[model samples]
Target: MTSTDRPLQALLAAHPADLPVPAVREALLQCVQPLTEREQVPLAQALGRVLAEDVVSPVDVPPHDNAAMDGYAFAGASLRPGEALRLRVVPHTVLAGGPAAARLGAGECVRIMTGAVMPEGADTVVPHERVQIEGSTLHLPADTVAPGSHRRCRGEDLRAGHSALPTGLTIGPAALGLLASLGLDRVPVVRRMRVACLSTGNELLEPGAPARPGAIYDSNRHTLRALLTRLGAEVIDLGVVPDEPAAIEAAFRRAAREADAILTSGGVGAGDADHTRQLMQRLGQVAFCHLAMRPGRPFAAGVLPAGDTAAARAPTCLFGLPGNPVAAMVSFLMIVRPALQRLMGATPQVPLPVPAHCTAALKKRPGRTEYLRALVQRQADGRLTATPAEHQGSGVLRSMLEANALIVLAHDQGPVAAGDSVDVLLFDGLL
Candidate 1:
């Protein structure tokens, strides 16, 4: 049978999702993920938020046609080559938003300014530079001009009832301005997804705390929080939980009660003290485990149904990530972020890969896809060279910060020599 027809267990034994980034991505996409939608929010608070419904304009832009230039408003057919016409300029000056009662008769003109309403029976505006205005008198050049010259038509920017923005579109500054122009003080946007984040393992200490022997400061919390915020999520930081089963279970239950999704790092691996996997099995249905990828092999995902009690009426999605800093971050970016977007009523998430050449030899093991930390820089020859960072270990957070791109080495691909082209996953450009 082809790979498509193969059983998941058989495929896992032969080629694990943990080893291939594409396979893991495909599995996550098939999990029936969907974002929730809710009520309207003030336009001021809608920036970076996705729209749940299309926005329609209630009125036309500009509302009426006006003059495009500061010139004489007159009939174009009354002019002849080299013949100057001296006409009486209306005593009333037509400033923008002023009265629009001025009218031009035969052999007559009105001195108009830019953005002033085009007078009745006037079809063209000769610029002030071409007209000689002396007090209440106006002089127009003899050349016959085209009709409708310099006249701005109403609704040129937008028509009434036009779709200004489509659903699923992320609102930006320009979109906010357009809504304001349409007199919209409030807009309907997708509700922000509430996410709860917690870091696991007794070996992890909070930043600024004294580091005990064999323990490191917790960086995953800050990294995940920043990432979730950038995705327009409402994040509830549960801090760090110990590796004990009780503590892990308590955190999961609390998150399941309070948030739409729960994310935790560490303790999903096969180690003796790894309680995240066991806790997940006890708390909810374990949908998938042990994808075939390097650095993030211990990734686990499941759904925690709301309990029968009144307090636990809301179900929450759970993601148990690897303990290693880099691995946790990579897993969160590839899996958790997309899931959260879907939960927030946004479109399917996709990461963009940039092409770059390897600057040195890179080694990889077969059957596991690798995301090697690399510092991408432009050379004098205008080519991008991805130089692998010094430390590639899963626990190395410094390497990820020092590097900008993750060089994706496909599964079963052995060694890559210098100057070989590869796809690099950029962290910042994914937005």
Candidate 2:
């Protein structure tokens, strides 16, 4: 069978209604086939892009043993107990670029700046604040210095000829700085994933247009496009499609032919006017999952054939996000975002859940998982606490705006009382 003809078993369960959130997520991830396209880009341009291969350090970080503080550099062996030791300071100070003019004597010290190379026989540094300099003499504090103290050793941060970053790591600001330290002007990174995004409904109007009765301005189209772009994807906006099967079919076909993935909001639920799901099944293999999750229960995923003309291209992964703004955003973060990352050649990672205590009682069912919008608070005692946002409704988009995290209540979990610990997924985390 062709790649597009791949069985639904890999992506779909026998029945979606009975599947839990975790099972649905695992099945959805199994459908992904990471893209192979890669290109070399400057380190400055690689931010938020996934690395295509492992990067090795060509030289040691700092390149030499240097002083970690601006202070006096001297030999520790000369320090005597209960004698109030003092060392004669050298005539000249050593800056960060070079070493001292003469080897440090047993009872002599050199005034050294931060990052300056450690001179011969000197294995300790006393900070300028810790010692009193009196006319070229460094008076040490009694019982305050130790051997190998405050010295930054060579290759401490990164050794020469060792793996600096593994493959599939997303290059962030710190990563760019690390690569700059290694003098890597350019590196190979996975190309951006192209996603065709849209909103589908007849009662929806574009933002600037007049909204009459039974019609509301389309918000998911803009939000989904922004979300996709924020994740380093090249978003091809397909705009709002009316609730016509033919119109929906055309949009899906066009998106499949042009983009790496298709993200649609609305028409995945079981409604008479929901033609997106029906058209998707006719055009490709789609799985309609009724996950046991709050905010987002109805979700859909599948593959859309791009046709044979683009033989090098694979079938476009399709994500049918929910119509509600909060539900759509939650679904994308929990499910579609991971799928997109995989398709973009990013390393497989389970998003970390931060532990926090609930500030108030939370009502939940035992059979379904919940993704509630919460304001994660850092207590004065250094403990983390999560307070649910007001009006926790799927359609309430403003609730999502006030949240810094999503309280992830498990499928088997029931009600949570005050002071009970819960795991929350950070909203500020990488998409």
lDDT of each: 0.77, 0.83
Per TM-score, the best of the predicted structures is 2
> Which window of 10 residues has the lowest lDDT sum in candidate 2?
1-10
For all predicted structures, in order, the TM-scores are 0.78, 0.92
* Predicted candidate 1 versus true structure: per-residue lDDT over 1-431, tens digit per residue: 01132233343566533436666565555553455457788889989899888888899887777889887787767666678777777666677788774566776777778888877878788887877778777876666356678988889888998998888777889999998989999889877888899988788899999879999888888988988898888999999898888998888888888777888877676674677778787787654567656678777666786565534244677777887778888887776676666667777566778889998988767777778889899899899889999999999888887998899887778889999998898767552
> Deviation in angstroms for 325 in model 2?
1.5
Off by over 4 Å in 2: 1-16, 379-383
* Model 1 alpha-carbon miss at residue 121, Å: 6.1
Which 10 consecutive residues of model 1 have the lowest summed lDDT? 1-10
Residue 210, candidate 1: alpha-carbon lDDT? 88
